[model samples]
Target: MADPTLPRADEAPGTIAAQVNKGQQFTSFDVNAFEIPNQREEVWRFTPFRRLRGLHDGTAVRTADPSIVVDGVTDGVTVETVGRDDQRLAEGGAPFDRVAAQAFSSFTDATVITVAKETELAEPVFVKVDGPGAGEVGFGHIQIRLEAFARAVIVLDQQGSGTYAENVQFVVGDHAHLTVVNVHDWADDAVHVAAHHIGVGRDAIVRHFAVSLGG
Candidate 1:
């Protein structure tokens, strides 16, 4: 996909910002760039504000990092724990809302998984995220990238008890195939919110399934 931050050919420089598909005007990594919703906004109207645990207003903060365990790695796969200053952090996209931006701003580290160009994995990759504890707050970010012509299946299983907000991204290169299955199975008292961004290159194919069986 073309970088949304770059000016169009017909426009002058410094004239671009990322935009959401339906309602958002612009995307930013800054949490304050977005306003706090009061249940009047379309997006937040259906959301449960009382269970947010301060993710919208920033009162709830990350107390401990989530324990991330990656399994089923193949030869062409690369997994890394990177700092916030990593050069590849936000180039693909930015947060569109306050909770997502707060997750972007508050996370102590990021999990990045990349598949090499033209490599196809026969086995699926499993990523399990264990939250801190009940009543605690956690912020997280994760990015999965598939280079040109690569094919892979990824399963994200989120577990534990807590209030968690996260921003997850997927970048698929041209002609690649990516299938993602996200399971949101948390404790009964846990509250979880997440924003996902999928950027597909020319001719890329992506299949995403989100199942909320718990929480």
Candidate 2:
């Protein structure tokens, strides 16, 4: 699905940056409620504006964290949390389009997922991010990475009890092997927006699996 957090016609780029700066960013609203502009807009044509909103209103929901557990790990998999400015994130000139990145980055100081550089591994790493609703707003960021020849599976499971919005991002390295599974078990009223940007280095492969259980 096209991320709901993407920009709308009325929202200016500078306005968006200001909102991010003030920490008053928008959540994963139902995208269908908005209108799709003509070809003048760069990213609108390829998007599914109708299905983007789905069949629900997500503004008033609360936040809930999804549950996750690392059931298995092999020798090739090593999991570590690195600084947000680690080498991988810096390698890409700009991982995300300026506005969207600033929206989530402004509110979040630390990234939840970080894999160290040159870390060799043989197993899978499971990461779960879930939030329960409180009839308010909830925003956060998650980042992931793999060094050269690093092999592993990263699983992301997201759920919400009330209604909430969330932002996420992931990265992969050259010759690195990564498999990611994302499960969305959100309440009907919840709005979830997760952004994943992966860089496949030479001879590196990353696989993704996403399942929407509820909502």
Off by over 4 Å in 2: 1-99, 112-122, 162-167
Tens-digit lDDT string for candidate 1 (1-215)? 98875656754222345564556466667676678977899767888887788988989978877889899997999999999888776665777788888898899989999999999999999999988788788888899999999999999999998888888889999999999999988889888889999999999999999999888
Best by TM-score: 1
Q: What C-alpha lDDT does candidate 1 achieve relative to the native structure? A: 0.86
Best by lDDT: 1
Candidate 2 displacement at residue 42 in angstroms: 8.5
Every model's TM-score:
0.89, 0.56
Each model's RMSD to truth, in Å? 4.5, 9.7
True-vs-predicted CA distance for residue 35, candidate 1, Å? 0.7
Regions more than 4 Å wrong, model 1: 1-24
